[model samples]
Target: MAKIDKSLYSKEEWLVIRNRRRLEKQLKKQKEQISYPVKRKSSKVAFVLGNGVSRAFVEPEVLSKLGVVYGCNALYRTFAPDYLIAVDVKMILEISKSGYQNTNTVWSNHNKAYSNIKNINYFQPSKGWSSGPTALWLAAEHGYDDIYILGFDYKGLDDHSKFNNLYADTKNYKKSNEGATFYGNWLRQTKTVIRDNKKINFTRVIAPDNYQPIELNNFENYNTIHVGDFQKIFDIS
Candidate 1:
């Protein structure tokens, strides 16, 4: 924990901080530490990313069959998800105000403003991770046998635009052509995490041909499958 600047924060502010810490500590104790390769019940889960391609390619019917849909960033604006996640401080704070709905929301432990929000889960990641990959890790921890990722286009800059995400306009998120810098780093870290946990099967659902498969060391864990196959795998109409 970083040393708090005592001069900057008043007693009330300090009290809130201490209370939040206490709450987070309690939450951590109750968190389930899911062991890998323990069981395989044929559960199918989908993690929907903010890339524009997901909006274009993945259909609602296919998403409905994926057992659960974990929406990233501003996905709530476009589609309803069983779980909504945000690790970015700004996005968490923003969504906490408006989209606090029936869906289960998981937020970073660093953002204490989300404390009062109902149906919210707090997670303290072992390392600094971006929202998408972190969501993958969390899903694996929850024991989903098969995980599908949709709209995870790694293209940070197209030939024409700086915007990388589909919901940037609605969420007021900044667009950068240099998406490869930050987004690329996140992908590498996420791939490492996926490689470490090989028990869970991960499929990139109907991604473009340009988005190459994330290779694992000493194993083949990741693959690309069509959205139609996603429906068949889960037996969803």
Candidate 2:
């Protein structure tokens, strides 16, 4: 378990470091061929849920908008999203016991403890990816044209109290800012993906000010809406 000083690296700088570490790890492991899941249907828009301040504003009806929902980490605890992604062992254990059988869960190899869990898609970590980045990659690979991400605020990196995920109180998770640096890595990695894929437009809905818009069309125009506003805007009721 190596660590990077969060104080020393900007989010972008940390991305460089994280990518290097991933390459080194892959080289050491000889790059196992991974069987990626089949590309999902090409939905016009998809939602990627993150645990952030705005997470409290989302309702189950907003997630039930026919648009595919890709939730990361503890999101499944609150809503049965269409897709769930996790790289943490504790989260995997929690989801396994939750008995919510609708979503397709994807877990990285960070914790191999849940490999025997049937129907859960296990992803081979290629170059040190986190849950959020892996989920974005899956959406992009699946040919989704538009992706709206929610609750992915990097505010906790500066203000620890903003780490208010629903599952923070759960066992094995710190009730405070347990992994701010890691969250920053996810942000940086997601930024890289958004920049690399010009065809796929990535939109961060209800994101905090710290998250800048990527170089995608209509990104600047995408308004950050509250739950009520989102419901009204999308006619979710």
Candidate 3:
């Protein structure tokens, strides 16, 4: 740990600094001691799992059997995908505390704040993107011929008036009664990924009543399929 000038900081600030430095050192040491397996590129198909309520019935394990699975924050509590992506600080801290990165593949933006947690891979170029779109970008980076986006409903569950998430009531998430989060950034990021990877077909699976944003329809490589139709196509039932 670097030497701290005690004279410059108050007691509470000094204590917080000391604790952060200690945690960073511990994480760095743990990273150096463990070895992780290199990911294999065996499949051309990829499934990016978003936390939208539309995909509540879809089983990640079932998708895992078919192709590579990429999931976002909080999903780790129930399912460990082929690759997990989390960019939020609170979510990353929670994941680190649980020691998930030690055994599973996790991807996040590179930050000096959490640089010592080197057990997981950091995103190149560090776009500082949201978890769902970042996961989509990661899937596109793998050169998958087809990417299916599940549970990416852009609106709230209750007719766009409330929160719409599979884990809304759980820790680190907004309550179901909370107002809907703005989807502008997510829409732009998702569109950028599709536009950049024109060769890759991007299929978004949604429920019958799920909101279909007008912006996405402009992309030639992007298309939306009903969740029931997607299930039938994949024999997921």
Candidate 4:
């Protein structure tokens, strides 16, 4: 067995642990505060974004007006949405651990812009195998009325056919993604989640030209939503 790092248990680590415990306590105190019926209903259209969303929709006002669930990268320096939700902490940790300090720097800078934002949420999978899909599925399972995934590209920025092209490294901090194959597992789970849940009114659309054929069929709800259509649907204009 490897020796434990005594330095890891230093003052900074203790302080973070203390804060987390305190936060949990405070949250438990709010159990009563959550008993009230939810006033604000989930939007008819909710958006999920990843890096793929960057260039796809130039005029995304329709999506912008509805609820937006931003990915980790989207939660960056000096840019953010009115509301946001994040998953894929595993990926973030990898990037953060690359000796680049990218995660902390980006979050710190972007948090300033999001200070006035109303709701910021985060969720994780039950386990590693279930992370991304579960996060999206849970959003709809709980109370989100409609979900529109904007930039959840699940591929590299330059790749034409594949999505999430950079997430496959099960090896190192800066490992190859085996070409974003992880998302295939996520998409498969997502399809079943959609099929099993009928009460939920959700539609998922990938960006223009990014749709993978046979795989897209797995999702029964992959309808084409145009820019104008999104505006009319969400009344963003």
Each model's lDDT comes to: 0.62, 0.64, 0.87, 0.46
Q: How accurate is candidate 1 locally (lDDT)?
A: 0.62
Off by over 4 Å in 3: 1-38
The lDDT ranking, best first, is 3, 2, 1, 4
What alpha-carbon RMSD in Å does predicted model 4 have with respect to the real structure?
13.9
Q: Between 3 and 4, whose lDDT is larger? A: 3
Residue lDDT tens for model 4, 1-237: 234455678888877877877897778776643332222435554555444443354344434545544333433323443333333454344334443332232221123333343332222212233444554554555455566655555554446333342222333223342334446676677676667666655555554545543665555555546445654766654
Question: In model 2, how large is the Cα lDDT of residue 4?
Answer: 73
Structural similarity to truth (TM-score) of each candidate = 0.67, 0.66, 0.82, 0.49
User: How close is each model in CA RMSD to the real structure?
Assistant: 11.0, 13.5, 12.2, 13.9
Off by over 4 Å in 1: 1-42, 48-55, 99-103, 112-119, 125-127, 175-181, 213-218, 226-237
TM-score of 3: 0.82
TM-score of 1: 0.67
lDDT of 1 at 16: 94
**Which ranking of candidates, highest TM-score first?**
3, 1, 2, 4
Q: What is the per-residue lDDT of model 2 for residues 176-205, given as tens digits with 9 covering 90 to 100?
A: 556543456776777677766678766666
lDDT of 1 by residue, 1-237 (tens): 566776788999989998988898777665643232222224455454545454465555456554666667777665656566677767777766675654545545455655676755666443467777766666667666677777666654464245567655454576454344345666686687678778877777654443554453344777777767766766754
Best by lDDT: 3
Task: Show where candidate 2 strays beyond 4 Å.
Answer: 1-43, 99-104, 124-127, 157-162, 176-182, 207-232
Clash counts for all predictions: 0, 0, 0, 9
For model 1, give the 10-residue run with minimal summed lDDT.
33-42
